[model samples]
Target chain A: MVKLKSNDDKEFEVEEAAVIQSEMIKNMIEDGCATSVIPLPNIDSKTLIKVIEYLNKHINMGKAAETGEEDDLKEFDEQFVNMGWEELFDVIMAANYLNIHELMELCCQSAADRLKNKSVRAVREMLKITNDLTEEEEQEIINDAPWAFEGPEIDDTVN
Target chain B: MEYGLIFLLINNQKLEIPQIILKSHPLQSKIVPKLTYNSNSCKTSSNTSVDKKVEEKSFATAEVATLMAPQIPSNESLPKLPQELITAILVRLPVKSLLQFKSVSKEWFALISSSVNGLIFYRIWFNSLVLWNPSTGKYKQLPDLMPTQMVTTGYCFNYGFGYDEVHNDYKIVALFREIRKHCVGAKIYSLKSDSWRILDDAQGEMLYDGSGKLVNGKLHWVTIVDGGWSIMSIDMVDEKCRKVEQPCYGVDQFSLTLGSVGK
Candidate 1:
């Protein structure tokens, strides 16, 4: 078993097989650097819980095809990324810190899919991003592709 | 993280064009060099110009980075992702979405444009061609082909871009056919000389009209030879077209398309 401590001073126990899926932790284990509880300063307890759930479910991923559980794993992944923007961002950061390749791809792809049809205003609002471009600069970008900026297909609702 | 290594044989000898590993993870720094600009030959005038432009642009990046540093959210508010994490998300978006999202912010505008590796050869219309490098903010408009304006209802035009290792130049190959006159022609444009020439010795009829795939110092295409589709490659060195052995796919009903992966 491997013990992981989140930034909120919460510690959780996980199986070695499951935790080893994280390349960062795996490397530490290989180098005898993970003797005690592994500290994750960047991830909070809530996000760490979510990541642990993912790692547990994705354990023995190579044997999933043989066991006919590939569809189950796929469905779990589909449901996993169906999170709010803020929550998804947390998961992405956690995945990056842990160096979990599949989770990072899943979260990033979900984020991209959500932002695919969103208008610039909707995107800024959803992510709470402050647009630092001057009006003239913004106008220049719009002028280059005026049709792209004002299309009916562009989604305006912030999800 | 799956690593891929693709091997190619050129002139009956192994030729490895640098390892093109796609390190998309935010933590790992991407090491893949841009194939559009080979870094080895720094003495070339165009190469030196590109280096100067990149240096200037990187200086601008540092200022932008400092300007963006404070805007990042701390512990209280919604956690804002780091710049690299944002880049990981943006790279997966479609081009249409990227175009719309360019107005999101100044950083987004720069990120979307500068994500391109090097030169992007794009065709606006049938006749007009453009080569743009977003990082350097440089663009060049190629001379419009008069024959493209002559494209009628039934005729088609195919174009391809690739690097010629032997001459150390970039080349754009264009194949066009005029149905009314029953004439087929091919043209090659060299970036070194900034000129175009019609290939007099090119067997345009046998050479299929399609986008050429650059692999191992050659541009490959599917050709119709004796009523059967066969693989044909054009040597970048001599500009000579030669037949290549096609992959043995047991089923003849499958359609064939040429594509190149890695740098």
Candidate 2:
């Protein structure tokens, strides 16, 4: 078993096979630094819990296809990332910190999907990002490439 | 009481507590609920510090975040992403979406317009053409140059699209036979000027058999003139038409087609 300690002092016990899915943890185990609880000063308890759940679920990823559980695993992954933007960002950070490749890809893809096909205003609202450009500056940008702004195929509203 | 005391001792000592004592603590369930609340408060306080560290780390190096933890943005209400993460998301978006969202901010506009993202062209319905940039999701439709009367005349048209390096423009060349007059006419459309100009010098008693092939700022077509096969090429730079002589004398005209060998 591997014990992971989150930033807020919460400890989680997970199987060695499952925890080894994290490249960072695997490296520590190889270096003999994993003898004690692995301290993750960057990840909080909530995000750590989410990361551990993902690691445990995807432990035997290679055997999933042979066992006919590929569709089930895909469904689980699809449902796993159905989180708010903030939570998704947290998961992305946690996954990056833990060096969990699959989780990082899943969260990043989810972030991209949410921003896809959204209008400028819609994207701004979704990300809660303020428009830092002045009206004239924005107009000049549109004028510089008028055809990019004139397409009828783009949606003006958020999806 | 023992578990609570041990937690206080660990906090004071800043030392790692053994996993066995944590798991064996009888009041672990009660302690977890209180810890959850404490962690929530701790998150709020540490978020800003963590964000600052992430910003410093990201700015200090241009390296990929391998083992180092990426800086999470501190603004909890708004999930403001770093420039690198935003680029990661932008590259995955379809070209159309990238174009529409270009007006979101100056950074996005610069990223989409930058030359790192190459342009792609797609032909729609054989009559109109759309040029798309996959990185920006932006597309521009070229103006239709084909006349309405030509569509119903049943005349076969051959088209050649190429870039003119000398003029720094894209040109679409169309050759169509005037069935009534038994003559062929060539028309060139310049994307820069957004207009088509007829090449009056190209009128000839020749038949264009297949599509034009573009090579080295020129368009080549197989033509049958006076029952003899010859290759006709148009130089996009000077807008001049010239015929390339057959490599061999008296080779059967039926077996010849215009093709490029190598660069």
Best by TM-score: 1
- Per-residue accuracy of model 1 over B174-260 as CA lDDT, tens digit each: 766542222457777777777787766555554342356666777776554444556777676777777888656664433344544
DockQ of every model listed? 0.24, 0.20
TM-score of each: 0.51, 0.47
| Candidate 2 lDDT tens digits, B106-136 | 4455334322102111111123444333333
lDDT of 2 by residue, A104-129 (tens): 67887788888866667878777775
TM-score (chain B only), all candidates:
0.51, 0.49
The stretch of ten residues in a row with the least summed lDDT in candidate 2 chain A is A150-159
Give fnat for candidate 2.
0.53
lDDT of 2 at B48: 30
Clashing pairs in 1: none
TM-score (C-alpha) between model 1 and the true structure: 0.51
